[model samples]
Target: MNLEELREYCLSLPHVTEDMPFGEEILVFRICNRIFVLTNLERIPVSVSLKCDPERAIELREQYPDKIVAGYHLNKKHWNTVSLEGLPPTLIKEMIQHSYDQVLAKVPKKETLKFI
Candidate 1:
């Protein structure tokens, strides 16, 4: 998917909001104000960094060594930067959802109910 497609997908998630806190060129998607997705707007092919389960993150990098890697400028153990140039769109959506769920899991139960 491209940058606009990625932005649309992230905004489609409940409680997700976009911001340019790092600057206009860096786009950030947050759930409950906690970032789950981030990307550089100026970059082509749309690489996105998403929060991920540690074990799954390593497995993904291993399985798609060229298309996926440890998150750039993010905690290597808990995030991944995925290149969208040739990866399956379904997989991209799943990774985005997983990142949303990871952050949602940390929300307080009462606050989380609003998203349910």
Candidate 2:
């Protein structure tokens, strides 16, 4: 998907918001005030960094060298950069959900109940 589509998908999730805390060029999506997805608007190929399971992150990196890589400027063990070009839309959606779930999982029950 393109940047607009990606942005829309991220925003569609519960309690998700977009911010440019770093700059206008980098778009960050958060759930419960914690970041889960980041995109570089100025970059070609429209890539996004997403939170991923550690072992799955490594496997994805090896399996899709051209389309997936270690997260840029993020903890390598828990994040991944996914290329938007050729990957299936369903997979992208799943990754977005995973990122959202990861962030949601960290929120305390009190804070989470506020959103729910």
Candidate 3:
């Protein structure tokens, strides 16, 4: 999906907010103030850095060598960088959803109550 489509999907999730703490070039999607998805706004083909299970992250890197790789400047074991062009839109959306769920899981129940 394109940047706009990705942005729209992320915002559709519960208690999601958009931020540019990394300046105008990088857009961040957060849950309870913790980052889960990040995209570089100026990049031609959108690239998203998403949180993922450590093992799955490694597996994906091996499977999609050219399109998916270790997260740039992120904790590699817990994240992966996904290029929109190389993967199907449905798979990308699933990855985004997984990242959102992972972050939400880490958040305290009291804080996430508002999302419900």
lDDT ranking of the models = 1, 3, 2
**Per-candidate local distance difference test:** 0.93, 0.91, 0.92
TM-score, candidate 3, is 0.94
Q: What is the per-residue lDDT of model 1 for residues 1-116, given as tens digits with 9 covering 90 to 100? A: 88878888999998798899999999999998789999998888779999999999999999999999999988999999999999999999999999999998988988867755
Candidate 1 regions with alpha-carbon error over 4 angstroms: 110-116
Root-mean-square deviation of candidate 1: 1.5
Best by TM-score: 2
Cα TM-score per model: 0.93, 0.95, 0.94
Candidate 2 residue lDDT tens string, 59-94: 889988999999998999999999999999998999
The candidate, 1 or 2, that scores higher on lDDT is 1
Alpha-carbon deviation at 49 in model 1, angstroms = 0.3
- Whole-model lDDT, model 2: 0.91
Ranking by TM-score: 2, 3, 1
